[model samples]
Target: MSSSVPPSIPRQPAAGSKKQSAETATGVTKRVAPGGKHALTETEKRGYALGVELGSDVARQQMEVDPKFLMQGMADGFSGATLLMTVEDINGILAEIQ
Candidate 1:
């Protein structure tokens, strides 16, 4: 019988990968109206995102946020890590954009 493994997954290891031995980083994409007037006007805001494989040892709620959403207009992303701000600043992320 064939191993029931996903074909898209790679089984090799990188010499200098930062992730754990069993975990791999997954990328996802999402597209959502930045939280602004439009976001309030439009009930449904779509978000595109990538997946980060946390590994089999733990349980994770899988979700994707588009890379574009990580831009300056959205959240303050730096050095690959997304930043969080106070409710005031966060709520106005896309305020100027739209």
Candidate 2:
């Protein structure tokens, strides 16, 4: 006699969706790659968070902001300064911006 159980179908990712969400069910943010290609490298995630924090600080200054220019400036600054900086140093910079 044959068994009556059916096979399970595999699930597939949606079309054109290359990366999965970086957050967890507990509402913690998982760091995805800077460009979302794969798992986040430390530099990539730090750089992104630095940019976001600094950009928000700038926005609160009420100046006209160009996002591309702002991001490029932050990238350049981080490239040179990150190696020599601490989180406190970065926070000081953000605090002094206003």
Alpha carbon lDDT of each predicted model: 0.35, 0.54
What are the per-residue Cα lDDT tens digits for candidate 1 across 18-97?
A: 33233223322322223332332232422321223222112233334333443432334324333446667866954743
TM-score of each: 0.19, 0.35
Model 2 residue runs over 4 Å out of place are 1-38, 75-98
Error of 2 at 9 (Å): 36
Candidate 1 regions with alpha-carbon error over 4 angstroms: 1-83
- Candidate 1 TM-score, C-alpha based: 0.19
